[model samples]
Target: MGTGKRRPLGDRYQLISPTGRDGPGIIWRAHDLRLRRDVAIKEIQPLFRADGADLDGARRRAMREARSAARLSHPAVVAVHDLLEEGGRLWIVMELLEALTLKETVAHLGHLPVHWTAWIGFQLLGGLRHAHGAGVLHRDINPGNILLTGDRVVLADFGIAALNGDPSASTTVPLHCAPAYVAPERLRGLTASPAADLWSFGASLYFAVEGRPPYPGSDSLAVLGEAVNRDPDPPVKAGPLRRVLEGLLRRDPSDRITADHAARLLSAILRMEGVAVDPPRLPAARLPPDSFAR
Candidate 1:
């Protein structure tokens, strides 16, 4: 991956075109050569020039993401269809979703209206509750990881997630959107705590309302520094949601709200605003129609 390039397009996928990969995998959108259906493909090479510790960690992580995603069994968590190896490349295929990333959603909406924000928050929390109850900790929760379809919000990108109580799990900085969403303890190589995920959810929703990232600067590193050392500026005119947001974004993980409590809080806000709500769906994401839906 030093060259970081995709494989050449060919007629291998039954003439169906390839899309592209989103994360570490070489993603291609193509017709399943065997299944004969549209699918997304993630290709991994075990012999890439990677740090020794990182190599085994990543391989284990990929296998975990595939299995953890499968066990999630929630409408909001992306479902894994299969994991395969062709030649020297390993791939993971997932369900395709018609959606925009929360990153793209903020770009399009400028800033989400609070009522809609609370409504979406409820759905996100619903998704988290299911995942948490299943003993999965979504360590890499952020805007870009979440997929949105209309008013429906789907949580995606379990690539860097860890199973609860699994001491073998670890965190990857480069894989996360903003280190701000990552728990302070996790930065020190500690295990992920459930409260940390709530902070991420709050920060993600805060970005939706604030337009800019909760901790914005020249780059991810700078934002990370600020998020760790300083409190983020509250969203412009956040009104009553300010307190709720603060509680969720608490730097001390133990002080932050958990998904179940956050869901109840978001529900209260939505009811007060008379906002219509929908059940959260497992929002799917794909590189393209022909290749992978990562």
Candidate 2:
């Protein structure tokens, strides 16, 4: 169970090969011996240093990710099957999705069709709505975290997600977030909010239709500066999705469109149906009590 050692989990989940790595975790494609299926296992450790604080932080983040994602029961959200701790390392077992990330998809097929982008946006917004209602804020919602499974879109990687009313939700950890997708308010040292996720959603959709991030630069600092100081160049290929993107990307959180409003607009565009337009009211359901407080 130590580093560089390959060990089965409870006589099942034989590790096959390394699939990818995220922040402080290594993802492995494994065979679930009991279920006779393939699963993705994420191994998290403080590989850089043996400092007690760093390892403790990594453990907390892994637990937070599992708890946050476990409460969300939506088809568009990746399922978390199990969490394990062995030899001071944490492992998370998830459904192995046979798909490509939105980032990979855009790289393969530049500038997705307008209707198709709207449909993808609609699905993502649905998942976001559900998460928000459940009081979970998916702080990181970029293209790389969105997966395309066949025709369905699923949001993956809740590593930095936060629950409402948690003190840690407001603490800024720059390394855990993507520079270009970070909200203007977040750049200004504000707390992470649902609006921040909306901004990221807008940026993601912009990348889908434009084949590039809204804020492009040579380095992380440059990208962050652009995100905080300038408006994204108008998207030429967004077509019907233009307005939705605009509303979500508003610099001021108060001015940005609510999740319900964005969903309504995207839904209309997706179905090719028409609806009268007006400002949307807050959803009736209040944010749920913290479900991750175990």
Candidate 3:
């Protein structure tokens, strides 16, 4: 999705700066003309034009991002202020976050303090809890998807899968997740579960501490097989964290840590970091076939 026209996107938004490139989309800082507040807009890339063969299918996938985003209304997830389709392109207007992504933090600071990692883990679990409540599965959960602004933490991308944006039927396999974060079932063309999100979350935590993925290799299949059939190298032996990671990376989805269990386990870490966590919000709709509790 290009700027479309030469004019700066309507008078309603003034482009302040370009953040960076994201696999999910490209984000820009702009001022919301109506609200007079800074906001971010993540518009689909020009991939649609490049892969022009599947124009029809790509259109629906773009629509799915907006739909899934609209289903969620929480502080932790980036708020979807508006979704627009014009000039044969789709754009998502989201809450402009002032903080850096976990990816950037790790890149610049190397490994973070254990407390910080634990705190981030708590926020991610809480966010996932809320997402599950909403009947949404964030098949993609990694360091890049989590953001921290000042003291506030939010999970940026919640729901995504082949059903939503993939040109194919397997949305669980996001290009952004790489091989290190995918669950075992996902690789087999299976739908996503909250437990799968937990598994990815655990892998992200490993990245934070170890600076390496649980399954590090060039081949996607090789990494996934190790992720499913083998155990991850232990974290830096940081007490409950080590145990927490072990449980999170469990090969069996049922054996993995539950979101509730994760929240409870991380409560201490949250308090120790002087972080006051708000309860997660659930989607208004009732349960689905893949209900977390069910």
Candidate 4:
């Protein structure tokens, strides 16, 4: 990322450097003048060359990302601080998370060990559980959106997140999310639920162990078709995680394993192999009775 000048937003956030892009915006590491801290600011640039309708949709999605993420508070989820509209663009203020995305980590390392992948999955499932309880469906769960920060795994980018029963969210786009990670039911135009997210998680876990998506293809259309019409290839390196992966990637959501069940299996994996790093803060395989009961 290149920097030209120190741009100020709302007279509080001082943009210092570019981080990366997420959803429809460019993320910058900015300084909070009032709080004396660094923060991540997502700048949704206006589509100057596009018509009014296209620009409006982008703005709506960007705003939704802020609002949806703001509703959740969890260790494994990114924190949204505020949202502002300035100079004809939307800026989302968020906690400055200094971490590498799971995608980047996997690309550099080829594949992660089974216990390590289980640790990552365990944290993400907790985050997804919390989001679902809040009626916010991530709709997008892939390696690119999973962040690894030391002992924590944070789920980021709620740009296309849909509140349960909110039809408008589903209407934002004809299709959403990375093709290989999309749930089979989503490809068939079915309503997305927590189960859909689990399917995507399963795909991500498969990638972590197999070094490729189960339904790999050269294009989106072909991959989406395979997801909906066929079963994923059997795992060759999942080892102890084979059962859990199969449970999650089942095409029928009804047959999909519940978060609690998945958590139990993940915890078992950690217990059997033992984690090499500090354990996650939260207790493994346990959720509040009122929040997530499968």
Please estimate how well model 4 matches the true structure, expressed as its whole-model Cα lDDT.
0.82
In lDDT terms, which candidate is top? 4
Q: Write the per-residue lDDT of candidate 2 for residues 1-294, one digit (tens) a residue.
A: 543366677667888888897666889899898999999999886635554447787788899989998988887789999898887888899999888899899999987888878878887777787888888888888998999997678998888889866785755744757777878888888888888889999999999999999987769888888888988898999888999999989999888888878888887786674433233334334666642211
lDDT (Cα, tens digit) per residue for candidate 1, span 69-110: 888776677777887545444567776676888888889878
TM-score quality measure for candidate 1: 0.81
Better of 1 and 4 by TM-score: 4
- The 0-to-1 C-alpha lDDT of every candidate, in the order given, reads 0.67, 0.82, 0.70, 0.82
The segments of candidate 3 whose C-alpha lies over 4 angstroms from its true place after superposition are 1-5, 8-11, 46-53, 158-172, 217-225, 269-290
For all candidates, the clash counts are 16, 0, 4, 0
Write one digit per residue (lDDT tens) for candidate 4, span 1-294. 445364578888988888898865689999999999999988876544444436676688777888899988998899999898877778899999889999888899988899889999988888887887777788888889999999789999898888876766563224436778988888877888778888989999999888888898778888877877999999989999999999999989988998778888888888899664343333343443343345
TM-score of each: 0.81, 0.89, 0.83, 0.89
lDDT of 3 by residue, 1-294 (tens): 444333445546665667875564677887777888988877665443464655555456567666766777666677787776666656677888888888788889887777778888876676566667766667777778888886667877533532322244463475556767887767667766777878888888878866667787888777877866777777773566777788888877877877767676777666766867654434455655545552
TM-score result, candidate 3:
0.83
Candidate 4 regions exceeding 4 Å error are 1-7, 46-53, 171-176, 276-294
Model 4 misses residue 157 by how many Å? 0.2
Q: Which stretches of candidate 1 lie over 4 Å from their true place?
A: 1-15, 18-20, 33-36, 45-58, 175-177, 277-294
RMSD of each: 7.8, 4.5, 3.8, 3.5
Residue pairs in collision within model 4? none
